[model samples]
Target: MLTPYNLPQDMCMKSHFIFLTLICPGPKDPGKKIDIYLQPLIEEMEELWAIGTPTYDVSTDQMFVMKVAIIWTISDFHAYDMLSGWSTHDLMGCPICMEKSGANWLTFSGKLSYFDCHRKFLPPKH
Candidate 1:
């Protein structure tokens, strides 16, 4: 089942930008990619996203936008992509974006990355 997972301890408890392997967008279920990467990741446990309380990272030797990311998932979300299953439309979004999955899943490479600041200060990815 698709459920909301915490961003990370460092993120929820503190502010930090966690690094994650960039997963390629797909139209179909991308099976076991762990064997193909440096991390042991599964289709259900691979994504790069941030949630509550903004996390931060070093930029020019200083902290930048605080954020956390998808380092591991406990379940598969491909089910959400299936028609009539649970498309991204079902996913929640921050009013800051003025939309839901309506906008788009946070991009791995972008300035305004998905960072919900509703209950916390999830900041935009840099």
Candidate 2:
């Protein structure tokens, strides 16, 4: 369901205002192939951005063209990897840092640790 941002922050969280766009049901995760399922939605969004849709304003009792542009997306890390084509594993897992990601592999734990990596991005006074 697409949540309208124009609504008040609290109203955006309400179930009734949310509109269901698409649904893909399957046994396994689509992973990298999610783009296939999203192609139609992408095309529709492109059309909406280019031409817009006719919408009615109840308060003004007037009709207008409503153009929509996706400002952001919300998804878990795993789904994020699938949608963004960025792996959320290993030393370079941090999307913002990319090649400069300050990740280290712990020899004992056999795991990647970010530790104090975020310090560099913080304000100097912080």
Best by lDDT: 2
- Which lDDT values do the candidates have, in the order given? 0.39, 0.86
Q: Mind giving the per-residue lDDT tens digits that candidate 1 earns over 8-115?
A: 444543324433544546784544442454344433344323333434543446544443344444434443233123333324422234453333345675434343
TM-score of each: 0.20, 0.73
Q: Which candidate leads in TM-score? A: 2
**Among all windows of ten consecutive residues in candidate 2, which has the lowest summed lDDT?**
90-99
When summed lDDT is taken over every stretch of 10 residues in candidate 1, the lowest stretch is: 79-88
lDDT over C-alpha atoms for residue 76 of model 1: 41
* Residue pairs clashing, model 2: none
- For model 2, residues 1-126, the per-residue Cα lDDT tens digits are 688886779899799998887676888898888888999989999999999999998878999999989888888889889888888887778787887888888999898998998899899889
C-alpha lDDT (0 to 100) for residue 26 of candidate 2: 86
